[model samples]
Target chain A: MKSSIEVHNLTTAYGGAPVLWDIDFQLPTGQIIGIIGPNGSGKTTLLKTIMGLLDPASGFVKVFDQPLDKVREKVAYVPQRESVDWDFPASVYDVVMMGRYRKYNLFKRTKDPDREIVLQSIEKVGLSEFKDRQISRLSGGQQQRVFVARALAQGADLYLMDEPFVGVDAATENSILNLLSEMKNEGKTVVIIHHDLQTVSDYFDYLLLLNTRLIARGTPAEVLTKENLTNAYGGQLTLLSKVVNLIKQNEFPIREKDSDV
Target chain B: MNDFWIILTASLVAINSALLGSFLVLRKMSMIGDAISHAVLPGIVVAYYFSEDKASIFLLLGATLTGVLTSLIIDFLSKKAKIQGDASIGITYTLLFAVGMIMISGWMQGNVDIDLDCVLYGDIALVNMDKVIVDGNLYVGPRAFYIEFLGFAIIGFCLWIGFKGFKLLSFNEDYARSLGIATGRWHYFLMGLVSLTTVVSFEVVGAVLVVGFLIIPAATAQLMTDKLKPMLLYACGFGILAVIIGYFTAVYFDVSITGSMVSVSTLIFLAITVLKRRKRQTKALLKSSTDLRG
Candidate 1:
């Protein structure tokens, strides 16, 4: 399998405090990959580093065997929903149209084919009716779908999402999951920073268990071992029940809507 | 003729600042407009000394550099030196403005044209006397008029070409960077525009009053709309209206023209804010009465 991302000894810091320490991973392509860890575990930091939004303090990261700048057009990023001001005066179509902008066509008018792609991306995320609606009027699930649609409009092969599932309804989650599966089927790679341990196995084929360092990286079943959990999760017993279910190895744990972190 | 020139010059100054101020307000950097206006005072003093002309292109360039410098210092102090954003801004502008003040009183003491009082309140009444000479005898127009007209053309062209990049930068800078856009280029380009607008409008509205023109009309429009395009349009319109109304009011009352204009803009802003709140309350009351009926 060709490598989608190769992080060789990446150490990133915010201000002076180093968050990620010597994270090394060469994730395979055409897989739904999840980066799982506790809060403040540098999951978002690593994702930002991969997106080239944050400069790593030490070591380097290569996407598709080249630097991020060399393959920037091939990458799409969906920031956390709370990262932007929801009250910003932009409609759903206006926000998604940002994806169609390129260096050559930035100053030119929005063409017909670009509009078609934006509409198709909106439809894929099930937001065709609310295309002209202002973003502030949308519900939490619909807001998340808007970001997904924007990323889809990029038509990039690699999608990097930061906690895309937080505060969204189950229906939105399933639809987004189906969309991710379809993307994977079309030979694209997706990397997500996820919080829900219950849906870990079902949502991702590749898992990167992280806690300031790369704890383990492989198939979800291979990476979710007891030893790996203890190393990354150190005294975080709140997730023990889900860990116990994984330890039992009987079946995949069903998602409890109320218990999501 | 003086009345027409004063009103035209003031309207031009108002619209120029309002157009750029729309972006500044949307970025939640309205205070930056205030900061940049004051911070460019020293640049104006320095450029005036070298060029010996207020409307010299060299002075515009020098002041724009200072404005961009102010932005860089604020970003550096906040991001690198770990100072709070408001503190850094306050520190930078006051320091630069004081330097400009010292240059005026210390060296340019006999120079009454660039006096501190004139720098603050400006002399719109005298703009008609300061004419642009074509061949040393033929007068063209007021210096402020030409300055603001050229500023308008430059600002309008940049806004047209950079509509996409600037919009993305205002909305989500990180997402814009992810699309291979150079966000730093747009950020500095905007800083440059703010600088240019403030420097040119200085002769018309003065340093402090330029911020009034920059923030008031844009803020007033913002209180009434939830879209960028209409907010900008309304801001430009409100600015012209304030210039016209304030021009007449100043003549009628024998008051300061620039002061009255900004004052009128504030009144408009306050009136709209109160009206919007009243409408919201009425809607809520109607909804409750309907709920009771149901």
Candidate 2:
């Protein structure tokens, strides 16, 4: 079977400074893959480069073994929650309907079948009741789900999401993961930029560890080793473990004072 | 009465401005319109210098070119210079407008028919003076009206055809690009349309008050609706309403027509904001009371 995504020597930059360097990865079809890295570790950049949001400085990216533009209709992208203006004059339904725009002619209006798909997508995300609500009025999780519903409405074979779990409640995160599992069961590929390391193994079948470059890529059990974790996190594991311990103790982590007294 | 014509013309101006303004307001680029309106002055001056006539097609072309150039310069400064978008706009128009004023006041020396007063306060009353006679009948009410009408049609058609693209680009530029949409091209196209609209409407409402027409009605509609289509429709409705009321008020009080129209829009915006705030507070209070009883 052909890979769902292929990248060879993929390098991306903003204003001539490299953000993603020498990225080479092949994601097979019908699997849930989690990407984890530190902040500014080119995780989002990799996703954006793959989705064709940012042009690569050099090298190439192919989706379904074809150029991205030619296969745009076969791919769905769930952008970062903060990338969109919440105050924009659009309801949840209107936003979902936008996913169908690529399927129709430039001048053609969205028809009943499009509306039905949008409704079904909303239902899948468990937001059918709030379909008419203003996007700004939604909570962080609902907003994230709205973006997922938009991707679902596109009915693409491949879905790429960036930080879908950020600021989301546990229940909403579970539902999102469950929805991704359902998509995977139906032979759809789901690539997500995830942040939490503890849930990485439980949530994803495959893992792509990155730190401004490719650190490792394999099954979660093979890729989430201590050495790979250290390389991807860069000595922050101790600090992160302490913070996690504080949370387990039902206390917030204390910060060191900047001024030495 | 001639008052009816005045009201009708004002309404038309309002509708045109409001329709285009919705997109501008949503993009949070309202100040760009303000900048283009001011920067077009230099173009007008250059055109008059070359043609020695305000009615020449050269003047319109010059103005449109300068308007588009102003937008491009602002965009370049914001992108290349790393300046904030608002600061770039502010600096660009201020410099261009200063040059325009200097050219008019210092070089022309009040000799040319176009002056500072005309740039600041347009002559809407004189719109009826020039009429088009076709087959021994007055067909076009005024040259200014026809120009504005043509502008309205062009902007309306462009926005209608490009509605999906505009919506996608404005709301999430990255998503639009990922979908293989050329966001930069759409951005420039929208900027071009804005400049065109600013030039066409310059003769009717003057430069200063064009910002009022472009911002206030759409902002008011934003407070009332969360859908793009309704927001645009309501903004147009609100703008026309304000224009009619402002025209009558201007006539009755003998005030500046443009000033009256802007003031009317501002008033409507304030009213809607306050009303929405009150409604939200009431809803919150009711919900709190219900929770307490439960």
Candidate 3:
């Protein structure tokens, strides 16, 4: 089968400095791939390059064996949860309806079938009761679910999500993981830029360890070994072990933490 | 009787500004309204220097061009020059406004048609003099009213037609672009409308006061609701209401009508803020009470 995503010699930069250095990868369809890296490790940068939001300084990204612009309808991207202003004055229904905008002409009203699909997407994420509620009134997990429902409503075959599990409750995380698995069962591909190391093995079948460059890519059992993680994490592995111990003790809550160190 | 025409013209200008201002406020570009209004001063002065008339269509075109240039300059400075957003707006508008002020004093010293005071605080009372007449005696309406009315129609129609695009562009630009929506073109289109609205309303509300109608009404309405369509409707309603009330208050107190209108808008915003705060407090109190009982 043809690869769902292919990146060749992809090097990207901000200003003059390079963020992604000669990154190459091929992701096959029907698998959940986790992209794990340290903070500022070009995980989001890779997703942005593939989404065509940011141009690569060299090389190119192909989605479903075609340029992103040509097969845009086949791909959906969920950016970081904190990227948008939650105070924006839009209802849940209005935002989800935006997912169906590509299907209609600029001036045309959304048809009944599109409405049905939007409704189904909202219901799938268990946010049907909050359909008319303002999006800002929702909790962080609900907001993340809203974004997922929007991606679902896009009806895309390939999904690239940026840190969807951040700031979400355990229940929301479970539901999202189940939804991602269902997508894979439907023969679609999902690539998630993930941060949590503890659930890496349980959540993803295929893993790509990265730190500004490709460290390793294979099954989680193979790539999540100590040496590969040490290469990806560098000196931060000490902090990583502390976080791992906290998770092991089931005391680490996923909330925003700031440290002066 | 004359107050009717003044109120009608002011209300029309308010509606136009409110319509475009809804998007500006949502996009967090409300300061662009202030920038364009001031920056158009030089454009109007230049156009009047050539045409020697306050009601020239050339004046409208010139000011609109300057408005677009203001936004472009702001974008260029912030994106290319690496200046911050508010500073870029400030640099562009202040420089243009200063040039306009110098032109009024140095170049066109004795021009009978232009008045700097009137430009700053518009004289709605004088709008009756600039009547649009067809054929020689057929009266249409005050020229300012017709210009602002046309602006209102164009803005309303554009918003109606491009409703979804504007919403998507304002809400999430990356998602819009990924869906192949030509996000840049839609962005420029919205900026173009804002410039046009600023120019069209300038003659009635002056440069500075127009900012009030642009930001205050939409901001006030934002506090009232969370949906885009209703927010727009409420903004228009609040704008027209302010114009009517401010006109009467000006007539009663013999004050500056523009000042009265701006003051009334500010008062409405403050009132809404207080009321919304109280409502939120009440809800929190009731929730805590229920929790205690449980």
Which one is best on lDDT? Answer: 1
Which of 1 and 2 is the better model by DockQ?
1
Ranking by DockQ: 3, 1, 2
User: Can you write out model 2's per-residue Cα lDDT over A1-261, one digit (the tens) per residue?
Assistant: 689999999888767778889999898889998998876688888888788766799989999999988889989999889777899988999898888876245467768998999999999999989999999999999999999999999899999999999999977898898898899999999999998888899988889999978999999989989899889886667788667655754642222110000
Worst 10 residues of 1 chain A by lDDT: A252-261
TM-score of chain A of each: 0.90, 0.90, 0.90
TM-score of chain A of 3: 0.90
Which segments of model 2 are wrong by more than 4 Å?
A: A240-261, B46-62, B102-113, B133-140
Instruction: Kindly list the per-residue Cα lDDT of model 3 for residues A67-169, writing each as its tens digit.
Output: 9988998998887777777788998998888889973577898899989999999998999999999999999999999999999999999999989999899
In order, how many clashes per candidate? Answer: 0, 0, 0
Clashes of 2: 0
| Model 1, span B1-294: residue lDDT tens | 788888999998998899899899889999999999999988988888888677789989998899999999999998789898899999999999998899988977676357777777788888998888898788777988999899999998998888887888999888988888888889999999999999888888888899999999999988877777888889999999999999899889999999999999998899999999999999999999999999
lDDT of 1 by residue, A79-179 (tens): 98977887777899999999898766778989999999999999999999999998999999999999999999999999999899999999899989999
Q: What local distance difference test score does each model get?
A: 0.89, 0.83, 0.87
What's the chain B TM-score of candidate 1?
A: 0.94
Off by over 4 Å in 3: A240-261, B49-57, B102-113, B134-139
lDDT of 2 by residue, B1-294 (tens): 456656666676777778778888888888888888889888887888888755566777788788888988998998888787789999999999999999988977666667777776777766677665678984646677767777788888999998988888778877777666777888878877777767777777888888788889988998888889999899988998888888878889998888998898899889989999999999999999999999
How high is the lDDT of residue B289 in model 1? 100
Ranking by lDDT: 1, 3, 2
